[model samples]
Target: MVFWVFGYGSLVWNPGFEYDEKVIGFIKDYRRVFDLACIDHRGTPEDPARTCTLEHIEGAVCWGAAYCVRGRPEKERAAMQYLERRECEYDQKTLVDFFKETDPLRPALSGVIVFTSTPDKVSNKYYLGPAPLEEMAWQIATAVGPCGNNRDYLFSLEKAMFDIGHEDDLVIELANEVRKVLGTMAKEKKLVGSPLKPLKSQTQPQIPTVQLHLLPPEAVAMDL
Candidate 1:
């Protein structure tokens, strides 16, 4: 049997393991949500960063990449071990169907193992449940942990989704909000080189003001 793993969030950009083949695919009946709290990779326990999770949403679909692990039994075991260590926070796994982007009408593979955290509010400590995009953005904007800045994670995922010709509206909108908050923080700290340029004051050209570019309606109207 070919071992396959589905990556929807960070795995989309960084699988952190070796795979024989990677295919762009989508999982049905679930949607990507930034409702999980990151106490390790993107934030400390004291201040957690909001991360992505596959939440069960009827008639919904989540676009991501599925990696196929091909090797001898020992090699495949090592690959699974590595992924489990990387995805330690995720406490649940479900066999789901994966549909390839090239032929989305049919299932490319069935019984593929997809890892995800429990959606229950009482059971999982890292599960933050659903919150407003702005609130989630704020958490992701300011939090930094061992891996790197939380904002970088969001930015990278946004770019990755775009690269795959899939515009996740939630990710796109939340990332923009996070950029706004980050821009304000940068102004306060006098940090430069942010992708969103600081506003230039006409009277005081030397002083940089914070002004974030809102995503145009056209951009938001792309395939969701």
Candidate 2:
């Protein structure tokens, strides 16, 4: 059987596994938000980096890349193992229908796997939930870890999306805000300092509702 995985964050730019094909597409009713915390890859436990996770909202459409793995079961197993370790921070493996850009009304593939975190902060230790734009920007600007700084991750995602011809406005806004914070720090000569405390959680803006196009029974089926 062919295995497919959908990437919306760093995986969109740096998929560490081999695949038979990569298709640019979108999933409906889900928006990307930088509310997940990363303490291992691009941050330390004391100062976790904020990363993207899918938030369900009516009418939202998240553009990303869907990778197809075929040929051998061993190869597919290897790919899944790599992703499991790489995306350890995400607490859930969600399956969604993928719609190609050319034909948004119909699904190109079904049961496309997407990694996401649990919404309950108490249940998911790495779930950061929602916060003010400024607070998120600050955490993203200052966090660093074994892999690299958090800002680089944000900027890389921004560039990757732009290169794919699907620029995400929320990503651009947060990246710009991080740049502004970094600029202020540089001017004040405060690049090196004690870690900033995590900001209090803030409510996310309500997503306006819109009627979603109904999918056919075959398209909505999860049995692949």
Candidate 3:
């Protein structure tokens, strides 16, 4: 069976999976979203520290590349394990979605993996819009994982955008802005304040109040 993995977010570059081909695939009703989400992989189950959001953009579709792995049963299994590792935050559940490539001439390719987590699991949801330039910039500048740095992501997207000759002022501008901000962060020793704290403040807060006085005779008549 051919394994199809969706590359909506950062997975485009660092999927940690082995694949032979990464082709641009189109998914209907689902566009890339930058809405932030706090996920378990990065933090405690009660409070996921940080993660990106992917909301459904109606009528609009996203164009992302997918990778097909050339491997035997064992190697493929290993690759799948790698994917699961990433899904730890998404509740270890993923959907196999099919898509049509943008290359009107090329045949449809089964490439791309979509991860769906429980409603509570996703801290925040976002629709297709300018990416979280700040978040991405921080990640790149910090170089937290195998992906190395957030600047790399920005550069890759910038290069890809130029290669496609598709000019998205919003994306491009965000990319540049992220680069600038990251540069500032680099100049400083570390980022001040917590980035994920903002997400946790969303939980509904309850307020208690005491009645000052009872209703008058008019209210008693209405009750009667």
RMSD of each: 20.9, 30.5, 20.2
Which runs of model 3 end up more than 4 angstroms from their true locations? 36-53, 92-112, 116-147, 164-170, 182-224
* lDDT by residue (tens digit), candidate 1, 1-224: 46999998889989888789998989999999888888988999999988888888789999999999986888789989998888777899889999977787899998888989998878898899998877888899989999999999999999999998898998999999998998888897765554565556634546678999899888888945
Best-fitting candidate, scored by lDDT = 2
Q: Score residue 180 of candidate 2 by CA lDDT.
A: 100
lDDT of 3 by residue, 1-224 (tens): 56776765556546667787776655666644433333333333333233433455577655555677665888778887887776554552445455654454444653345765544423423111233667554543443333234345556655654554543354466567766876787666455543545455577685778778889999999999
lDDT score for residue 76 of model 2: 90
Sequence-dependent TM-score of model 2 = 0.84
Segments in model 1 whose C-alpha atoms lie over 4 Å from true places:
190-224
| Candidate 2 collision pairs | none
Error of 3 at 146 (Å): 7.6
Relative to the true structure, candidate 3 reaches a TM of 0.54
| TM per prediction | 0.82, 0.84, 0.54
Better of 2 and 3 by TM-score: 2
- The Cα error of candidate 2 at residue 197, in Å, is 35
In model 1, what is the error at residue 30, expressed in angstroms? 0.6
Error of 2 at 171 (Å): 0.3
Question: Model 2, 94-127: lDDT tens per residue?
Answer: 9999999889999999999999888888999999
